[model samples]
Target: MASPGIFSEVRDPSERVRQLCNYACKVDIDEAIPPKRYLRSGLEMMRMAKVYQEEGNYESAFILYTKFISLFVEKLPKHPDFKTAPQADVSAIKKKVVASFASAEKIKAKLKERYTAIEKKRQEEEKRIQEELARKQAEEEARRKEIEELEECKRQEAETKWLEEQEARLQELKRQEVERQRQQEAAAAAAVAAAAAGINSGAPPNFLNNQIPSAPPGNLSYIPNDFGGSTKLVDIDSQPAGTGPIIPDRDLKKNLLINDGPSVSSPLPSVDRTTKPPAYDHFMSTGSSSGNKFGLRDVIIPSDLPRKFLVKAEHNTLKNIETCGILAGKLRHDAFVITHLILPKQSGTSDTCVAEDEEDLFLYQEPRDLITLGWIHTHPSQTAFLSSVDMHNQYGYQAMLPEAIAIVCSPKFNETGIFSLSIERGLVEIGSCRQKGFHQHNKTPPLFEDSSHAKTVDTEKIEVADLR
Candidate 1:
């Protein structure tokens, strides 16, 4: 039972390929084309495929054409009806299937060409982004190296200064030691002279020991010197002293201007250099399995559509009566492009218009594979806005497909607007309300807003089927 209609909603291209395979396996080929209206309905796929191709929706066109070949060229011949059918019917079917095979092949070639160009452009863009990222990375690396070199040079300069200060302190300490040596020599010479005087004058030699002063307590201490019987003063303060008041060093290591490494300098800010390819629109969607909450895809409205419909419905407008038309089209490139504006047989009053025979609309759409995207109507004398009645009417279309829209045109007010019921609020309000025609409802959080998913385009001319 799987058919082209099953693909009306947006789906991933890969999933669709799998679906096609599964469909082929499960399909009962013998029962595919049943008797009664088989001959008439057999051509429906071809008709719809031709419409897709003519409308420039190549993806949908290609799919329909392929399906047509699968059904008629491959499946129909195996059907029970075909085995007992008249020779003329069989001959006619064979001729159409052969022609369809040719059309499908032609469209396949076009699709190949279209996709090849798209892929080439995408690769070029990707290469450009990669090149840009590589260039930036190189610049960051060079900057980091420059900072490291500068910091190293500063560290070397600081180390050299510290060494020079230590050398000077060593020289100063040697000079101080020499001066102490000279003083000790003088004191020893005086003691020896005194001892000689004491011996000559018959005084005690012990007086010489008393004349010499004891060394001071603290970091300073005296030791025996190489010079005659004199004690050399050793500056033990050159090393760290015993526990007492702390003495400041000639050079404090913490205050020295030295660079440890690159960690000292500010690090470069991180940048996200990765880039992703553009999303494939149209028939390709990576949407969730739950389906698009707002429905399939963008619903395209033909530009100046309101004006065109107005021209067709001028008679109704002149009489101060309303006119309505069905906005219908095939899915193209993940969008429902409104290609046909059908003025279905209908009657109207100054405020509202109703289609008389809806069956006529469905009958016309069946063979063409058209989906009802939305509706457009003219409010001859009123302003371009949906009324309470209009809200209820639009709720039905939106309920069927969340992407559906309602376009309101008012020639008298020189206004035309595309609108849709608010899914969050409008749909709920209208769905619950039972009132009819021109009645008021809570308008604080208004029921509808301008359509965001629908856009007017001028790329293709819209076909008007004025069934009236």
Candidate 2:
């Protein structure tokens, strides 16, 4: 429909219907209606049609227009005043109908143009809104990436500072240890010297009472009667000696001398000493069993999985095993179980076709004290030593719960196998088997059975197509 004029000169269908109904009701059954009134009613009906057409109510306008034309034709032939009325009036009414129809057409055309313009504007607005949203999302992503980069940089800086501090402490410890050794040596030397001086000064001399020959006779000879009594002389060498004093042997003295050299020469006392201030034992005990200085588990652990899983598993048998495990553990506990949903990409019909379903597994966490024996999944193949995908999944899975084992099942025989991954001497391996229940007699030995083979696997390069 064409756009209506600002003054509403165009007629509307409902108005036309009301005008017709009014005119028809006003018609007196006792007296014949006047031609002017009938003509006025027709004009009003036409005006209503014009309004309806302008407003894009074509169906109602068409119906009203048809009724007005039919009534005008029917009454014009039989009315008493129809013949007496001025021909011009009849002509004017006819012209007005034609004009109204024409106006209705114009209104329709204008309306179509307006609708087209409005639709185009709407499309443009939607596009603009979408572009704005995209721009906002891009900005948000960039901001997030920037924040992450800043955090990583801060972490690296902290790590570097920590390493430098540790090195400085180690150097200081070495310096203190050297100083202590010097002091100990000095004290030992002083003690050895004191002992040596005491020994040298306390020894007894051998020259005692020996008789000299009679003073070489010469000096004159007066022999007294007292001197004539028996003269007895004892030689220093002739007496039988009692047990001699026990002196240190030469070897013993030599050893003591060598050992005492550093002590005697140094200037510091021999004593235990340390430069570092004493610290409380408890301070040293603050750390994880994994030896990681940072408590990464606190940050990476999932908070929502347990609650959501439990809600979804009220009727399911497996009962969201992982969620159960998470709840059983203590609050803010270190333990968490993560499961990855994996799907096979290829039908495995042909060897040449590379499977596209080789996507990484989705990770899900289980609640604590769940008494779960690790993750369980069915394998398409008969033999299940973790496939390349499985290994990749398990390794990442184990990072969150290193103590947990992985269970792989083969649906055909209902056979299930479990494997544990561990790090040993800087190498990743299927370290040990706690228990492998299925096909117990099978030749495959426990995990640690072949060290060489485990070490040969290059686990890092394996593909990890994250399904998430």
Candidate 3:
């Protein structure tokens, strides 16, 4: 509460002034409550304005100093005791109020500069973040476009293969129709001959008893038993000579070397169905069954193609760590050969793990010149072999390109292997496997074949710009 007489009803000019003086002299200037004396109360406010100025509350301090000057200094000369008060004391309070306002203005200037600097820094940081986001978005879009193009190429390849196979089937059907018609015509001619000779038309021809000229192994000719209706693909390779005329539906026969107009005599080499394909990819120009599927030219690799991976593994900080990358190449007229071996940024380890990155610098290096053919990896310490993880990786590669090959090099163990899954066999089985880590799988007919010949190196050297 205020002091006793601060709000009293005393109104005498001299008597009330003495009472007010008594109240002013007894009031504590430093107390939390305001003093009854305006002089001391205004002086205390001037000190508080200095504190507010240094604390960066410039506006608040300026307002307080303004109120002190208007209420106290404007009324200083009106005070009855002004002549008795020290002139230095009055000057000191005026100087202090002026200093407080000046300091508040200085703080305002500093705050303006500080705020401007903060805003500029914030804008720069925001721009940097936006730029980073744009970069990542562009790289992601590029990778997505690459994946779409690869998928489209695979779709076209599959469609072409399907069309070729359909054409082959249609050709086979036409050959069968021709073969059947030839038998019917031959039967009709035999019937005419028999009837003209005064013999039964339905009876078997006498030529059936006499030995006829044997047809070629592939283009076998047959005369039906008087009535010709149905036809069958003949497997003359399995049939013996003395048992009957051997009929063949082998590739040579399916090629339809038949007597559409006149019969041609061409010898056919015997084929062994049990023979397996070569351990490595090589030109199969024998024109045999194997040549029908793998007719493309043989893939070739140079001896020093993998020197970069070896050198990189040796010089990097983690000497014993595993390394992996994509083998990029292109398809020529007859062969698919490696033109660039891209070392994409990845998280590799001693035995396993090759994490993929969508924004990898290598993804943009190929542009329109290269194609991702397969994968390559180093085992650091272990001998070369496809682990379960390797199987999963190569499965994706082979799906994109049938001729995709896997290369496993062990720099420390001095081992290297180039291989591909045998048919849609082990790799196919492994693709659907639920197990993780290394494990065994039971597969027949062998799982893989050596594909070392498919690799080759170009004169172009590895560029740091490409790996960045």
lDDT of 3 by residue, 374-426 (tens): 77788887888887678766765554344678888877668878877655476
TM-score of each: 0.52, 0.27, 0.35
TM-score leaderboard ranking:
1, 3, 2
**Clashing residue pair totals per candidate (backbone < 3 A):** 2, 38, 2
Candidate 2, residues 1-468, lDDT tens digits: the string is 331222122234344333433432222210133575455445545544545555565433544454554455554547766778667658877877666556545544554455455556767987997797778778777776776676666666665555455345445544654565566666556655655665789943222422122211112112232333232323313433431112112222222221111111222333533221112111111112222212212212133332333333232223211111111111123223232222223322211112243111111211111211134344433444554444444543343333434554443354545555424311133212223222232233332111111111122121112221
Overall lDDT per candidate, in order of appearance: 0.65, 0.37, 0.52
The alpha-carbon lDDT assigned to residue 289 of candidate 2 equals: 29
* Candidate 1, 1-468: lDDT as tens digits: 011232322134445434433332232232422432344334444554566677665555556555555655566566777767666656666687788778766766665565566556757987997798778778877877887888777867876776565456555665665676678778878888888998999977987454774442244232222222222223446444331122234345347665454543334555634221122111122121112334445777878677789999899899999999989887654556889999999999999999998768867987677777789999999889999999988976765456778999999998898998886789778977878778998898999989887877888678899989
Candidate 3 global lDDT: 0.52
